[model samples]
Target: MSNPADPFVEELRAITGAAHVLTDDASTARYVGDWRRNYPGAARAVVRPASTEEVSRVVALCATWGVPVVPQGGNTGLVGGSTPDASSREVVLSLDRMTRVRRVDPLDNSMTLEAGCTVLAAQEAAAAAGRLFPLSLASEGSATVGGVVSTNAGGEQVLRYGNTRDLTLGIEVVLADGRVLDASGALRKDNTGYDLKQLFIGGEGTLGIVTAATFKLHARPDKVVTGWVAVRDPQAAVELLARLGDAVGERVTAFELIGREALAQVLAHGTPGMRDPLAGEHAWAVLFDVSETSALLDPTPAVEDALAGAMEQGLVLDAVLAASGQQAHALWALREHVPEAQRLDGPSIKHDISVAVSRIPEFIAEAGAALEGLLPGIRVVCFGHVGDGNLHYNQSRPPGMSDAAFRAREEAVHDVVHAITARMQGSISAEHGIGRLKQEAFLQYKQPVALELMARIKHALDPENTFNPGRVLPLPVATPRPSSL
Candidate 1:
């Protein structure tokens, strides 16, 4: 229990019932650490607010007391965005108790949900309404709407249905000053002024806390044909995408590139029933899906012919067509399980980078060579949504190098990957936001004017820098010279 004499704790307890304010180490442990165990944090208490009103009150109280706030959702973020700092002074404002489907307008093809609602819950709600909410991720079971919107997450279906930002029509945010910025209407076209919601969408809880969101829904695909193929390289995967685009372009829902090391990890250490999609140990592979909304349409034949064409063009080495829905799920499991497999294998330096779809091959080849030159015998794990140019590239320590030595080279690894990314006109971050993990790189890579404007916006919205401090943006650097003043 928090000290009753501390008026701040008592105030927090009052804003959110005592049961919701977790002060003990046991209760606050999960909220203070990220999933990767890479960025651990500390907080005095974890405050769980149940509604926008409660959130506003808590934020107001914190602002009045000049206390910094860290907004958290499902706590599934990879970049420590939601984790509280080690200061132990910041208040963790969690939305776990705010899971509510406020409204579902099936006629408008929209759904309004509270921020704490899990991505899977949102999908099930849409399915219940005979619609499809397409934003998805491996962490969907645990990731929340607020986190997804705040990070503007992109997932497997981005190739067809777009990301959370594209699906989100409106949002409700609790500003740092405790004002409710309610734009949660299901407006498809409201061109009156600047889209204020976009700022909060990818803000990573810096500008404000997303309390609720309104997301667009699509026609639920009745049938989905998924398959896996062994491709010669990333270029082959790109060409295969072109071929599929030429044939079943409308139905090409997902195209993921999986590296050999990624697949080997999955097959060797992943789920019990996991196995390679093809017989041989190919250098690279792909997992793709074609979905059709109409009940009468089956895209299997078209997909088969396209795969055949890709094979004839030497784009695909071998193919494995999922015979049933069960097989399709198994294949996707192979892709989804890579992250966990890698985690189980050992520590690694990770990169979430993107390049133009056309330049993926070059990026992969150059980045691989550069990393090899930096650290010979390094194990590279590269895989991602090739259709959209996002790649989850990771590097494990060399055979005999100690984990400490490899860990010491993390900044160099990031530099190499990001340098190649910049050379290829690519983004340093694709789906992952610039949380504490990428703040330095963000400062180094982001254009100066853009960074200045972002700083201005941050100042305008959160002048005190009370919201998720030391995230997304770094504080201005001062020269070491003696103060002339």
Candidate 2:
């Protein structure tokens, strides 16, 4: 006579306060959709839990009721990993209220933080403690530490600091059966059996809900230098990157590349007060950042020396080393504001892909040419972490095209670009995980053996698939028979 889903909601409400359990459509709107506004969905209810115990209780209850649970943080994930399904049968577990800097040991160079803390907030906390938290991103202002850890996000600084995985020393997770896995041990070297924390680092909430993490921090650099260099081509940019790496070595923190069209779009529609670094138009641009110890050398002179050498060798056509902090911020703004500028231009198809660092130039040239051939008049805006070989290869409609029309062709264009990526032994989803957007595509690229292994892990962990169903791994498809001679 009564709905089966009702009791589950009631139980969840009882566990994590009635005020924290949201069932109404209005309150769940933010948790029901993806960042790109691609996969809007509905959930039975949304649960905001402030502690690991509450999260464990909700997950256990949902597991018992055969109801799926989606763990969310900040809701800034580009993929649909955090969004609930449209079935309205799942419960969304939000970690926004658990924000706190639990501990900061400057002597140990580590900080313990709750899952709800924003990336920027963690950085600030570390800075206040006279340490550095270097997991920087464009969405740092809104992206939470838990979500960053869940996705294992890599940003501009990954060249030197590495991704979220490298920064994380340990994690605390709430398992499906109301069990808590206390994997957080702040030691720098732990060779304990099977590193369990890594299992949930990039699990996309399929394994367990990440409640807290202990991140390794670094000493704040005494000197910082940022440079913007113009290159004649992608090859030249790659060469300049190599030269800079040789010159600065490990101090080279960030190395990013921007195509001509991407920069043009940014200048045309981006936020005001950011000046273009180059005097004349160039085909591509590279932003390289350097940080060093005062005991050894000053980073400004090192960066300047690298640029001068690059220019002499013809790897860099033109360059500008930031004269002041204001200029440095302005130069970085051009790179940071690219995504917003792309959105303002029109509907754009995006691919966060990675290849071998040595093959980036070739990948860009070949992939761009292939996509352009498939979709005529499409403007290729290829840019991102060249040092890490991750490119945000996006395609925008040519001037005067309707947004609706361009958007309509998104799938076909994505296929073309992704196909080339596959052929080149590159990834379809790089920084962004395979949420709903690329779940099916992941099947096309991933080996059959690997898929089976992933499924086994998922089943072993959350036997009922009660954590974020219909995500990461695609629904199985029937394999066709091979034609025999």
- TM of each candidate vs. truth: 0.97, 0.95
The numbered model that scores best in TM-score is: 1
The TM-score of predicted model 2 comes to: 0.95
| Candidate 2 ranges with C-alpha deviation above 4 Å | 1-5, 476-485
Give Cα distance to truth, residue 28, candidate 2, Å: 1.6
Q: Model 1 segments beyond 4 Å from truth?
A: 1-4, 476-485
Model 2: lDDT equals: 0.87
Q: lDDT for every model?
A: 0.91, 0.87
Q: After superposition, how far is residue 120 of candidate 2 from its true place, in Å?
A: 0.8
Q: State the displacement of the C-alpha of residue 426, model 2, in Å, after optimal TM-score superposition.
A: 1.7
How much does each candidate deviate from the true structure in C-alpha RMSD? 3.1, 3.3
Model 1 poorest ten-residue lDDT run? 476-485
Q: In model 2, how many backbone clashes occur?
A: 0
